[model samples]
Target: MPELPEVETVRRTLNQLIKGKKIDHVTVHLARIIQRPDDIKQFEIMLAGHTIVEVERRGKFLRIIMDGLILISHLRMEGRYGLFTSSDPVAKHTHVIFHFNDGTELRYKDVRQFGTMHLFNPGEEFQLPPLSKLGLEPLEESFTLEQFKAVLIGKKTKIKSVLLNQAYVVGIGNIYVDEALFKAGIHPEQSVNSLTDSQFERLHNAIVSTLSESVEAGGSSIKSYVNGQGEMGMFQHQLQVYGRQAQPCENCGSMIEKTIVGGRGTHYCPKCQLYK
Candidate 1:
């Protein structure tokens, strides 16, 4: 799954490519991918002829702002978007196509067919599921160290699980969670309540620094993830422990190990991230 950085990168790229383009028509090859309106015809009719005003992201979802409606799209694992000329042949697994009046089409392709789209009124999007329950943005001014620590108080869940929960802190996934825990010198299996105030501060900083750096580098392309322009991210080169199991730790030269924590495959340095 694409994390915050990857989703943000896609939002930035799609905003540049599709903004101001009028939708001449919409083609839904997979009917189930459209979750809004329930009726496919209504979905197509509502989107057609509407101009894309902007593209924004909340958590892992993308919102394509139009004249009066907002199209909220979640690109689950293996889903991607690309822009092509209408004359070009559509690629396989292309689930949705937004045909623009300028003879170009924005295509959504998801090999796993797990992507979803929901249409909502302008001001009602955040009041509903998915976006409504998401926690503060880690990079934003609202996510302070005190707020982060306060959320963890009295929680018995593993630190890794707590961070992965979008209700507590949005935009973190398995890869980045492992990296953040490792950077903070906290074992993934550590209980949230076991962390000291100093440890919480370090973890908070690690989360912010890791995400900010990944966004700047486009995001880690560990699998099939790519930006809206079909460009692979460069952050994978900077990974410390996420996919580097059995590799030497950069800080302590200790062998990085992998273990299952809260049902997720977690990687960490045994010596550096000592269990306390």
Candidate 2:
């Protein structure tokens, strides 16, 4: 799945491609991919003639700001957005396409069919089910170190599991979680409540630093991830332990190990991130 950096990169690319374009029509090749209004036909009908003013991302969801309604999209595993001329042939697994007035189409292709779209009124989007429960954005000014540590208090879940929870913070997935934890030199299975003030500070810094650097590098391309223009990300080549199992640690030359923690494959250096 594309994490914060990957999603942010897609948003930036899509914004550049389709920000002011008007949607002439919409086609939903897969009915199950549209979750809003409970009817796929309505999803296509209402989007007709709607101008895409801007594209915003909340957590893993993409908000394509139209005239009065917001189209919320989540690109789950194996899902991507591509912009092509209308004359181009529709590729396989293309689930949704937004036909623009300029003879171009913004296509959403998902192999796993796990991607979802929800339409809501502009002001009502934040009050909706999925968006309402999300916590603060890690990049925002309100996410301070004291507040970060407060959230970890009394939580016995593994540090990685706690960080993975969307209710705690948004836009973090398996990829960033592993990368950030590894950067902070914290083991994935360490109890959240056991972290000291120094550890919390380090983890918070690592989260922001890892995400910012990845976003700057256009995100990591691991297994078919790309921006809206079909360009690949370059951050995967800079990864330390996420996909480097059995490889020497970049810092201390310790062999990186892989284990399943909270049902997710975790990679870290056992010597560097030892449990207390």
Candidate 3:
């Protein structure tokens, strides 16, 4: 799953490529990918001639704003978008294609077919599913330290699980969660209710700093992530613990370890983030 930085990078790239481009047509090869309106044909018809006014991102969801409707796209694991000439051969696993009037097309390819798209009226997207359930974007002014702490209070879930919950704070997945926890020196299994104000502050700062830096670096290309132009991200090169199990920690030379927390593989430095 592409986290906040990766999704934000994709949004920036898509904004540059597809904004102002009028949709010539839309092809939905995988009907199951369209969730809203529950009709693939309606999804295609609504976007056929709509012009992309702007591209925005809410958490990990890509919001492609058109004339009166908004297309909410979530590129789940192994999902990616790329812009190509209409004459270019469609790649394998291309599930959706948004053809542009300029002879170009934005292709969505997902090997796992786990990506999803929902079409909603511009003002109604937030009042319904998906977007309605998402929590605040960490970069937004509304996600203050106090708010983050308040959400953690009385929550018995592990700190990692709380951070991963989209209802609590959106756009964080396994990779970035591990990275953020490692940076904050908070063990993935630490109880959320047990964290002190100082630890909460550290975790908050780590989330913001990690995401900001990754967005600047074009997001981490850990798996199949790429931008609108089919470019790979560069932030994976700076990863501290993710996918580095048994490797020495960069900070203290302690061996990085991996364990399953909340059914997800988690990596951290035991020496740095030991159980309290």
Candidate 4:
């Protein structure tokens, strides 16, 4: 799953490429990818006349804003979007295509076929499922330290699991969670309730700084992640702990370790982030 940074990158890139492009037609090569309206034809018809006003991101989902309706797209796992001339040959696994009036097409391809799309009215998207269920937008002005601490009250789950919960804070996934925890020198298995005031402050700052820096670097391309123009992210080079198992820690020179925490593979510096 692409985390906040990766999704934000895609959103920014898509806005540059497809914004103001009028959709002449829509073709759904895979029906299951359209999860809303429960009707493929309706989904296609609803999108045709609308011009793409802009592209926005909520957590890990892409919100393609049109003239009257909003299309919510989740690029689960290996899904990708690209703009190509209509004369170009459609590649394999291309699930959806939004044909523009200028002989250009925005194509969606997912090798795993796990991506999803939902169409909703303008303001109803925030009041409905998925979007409605999201918690804090960490990058926004509202994510304060005081607010972060308040959410941790009564939460006894492990630190890794708590941060991964979308209801607690949106857009963090396994890779960034591991990186953030390591940056704070807190073990992944540490209990959320056990964090001291100082540790809580460190963790909060780590989460913000880690994500902000990743977004600047275009996000970590650990898997098949790419931007709208098919560019690889550069942040993976700055990773400290994730995917560095058995490798030397950049800070302490101690070997990094990996373990299972909350059913996910977690990486950490054993010497720096002592397990309690």
Better of 2 and 3 by lDDT: 3
What is the C-alpha lDDT profile of model 1 across 31-135, one tens digit per residue?
Answer: 999998899989998898899999998888998899999999999998999999989998999999999999999999999999999999998889997588988
Computed on alpha carbons, the lDDT of every model, listed in order, comes to 0.93, 0.89, 0.91, 0.93
Q: TM per model?
A: 0.98, 0.97, 0.97, 0.98
Better of 2 and 4 by lDDT: 4
For every candidate, C-alpha RMSD to the true structure in Å: 0.8, 1.0, 1.1, 0.8
- Give, for candidate 4, the lowest lDDT window spanning 10 residues: 147-156
The per-candidate count of clashes, in order, stands at 0, 0, 0, 0
Candidate 1 at residue 92, lDDT? 95
Output the lDDT of residue 242, model 3: 94
98-152 in candidate 2: lDDT tens per residue?
9999999999999999998889988788998778898768877788887887767
User: After superposing candidate 2, which stretches have Cα over 4 Å from the reference?
Assistant: none
**Lowest summed lDDT window (length 10), candidate 1:** 128-137
User: 1-276 in candidate 3: lDDT tens per residue?
Assistant: 899999999999989988899998999999989998798888888888889999999999999899998999999888889999999999999999999999999999999999999999878999988899888689888889999887678888898888889998999889889999988989999898889888889999999999999999999997678888888999999999999999999999999999999899999999988876
The global Cα lDDT (0 to 1) of model 2 is 0.89
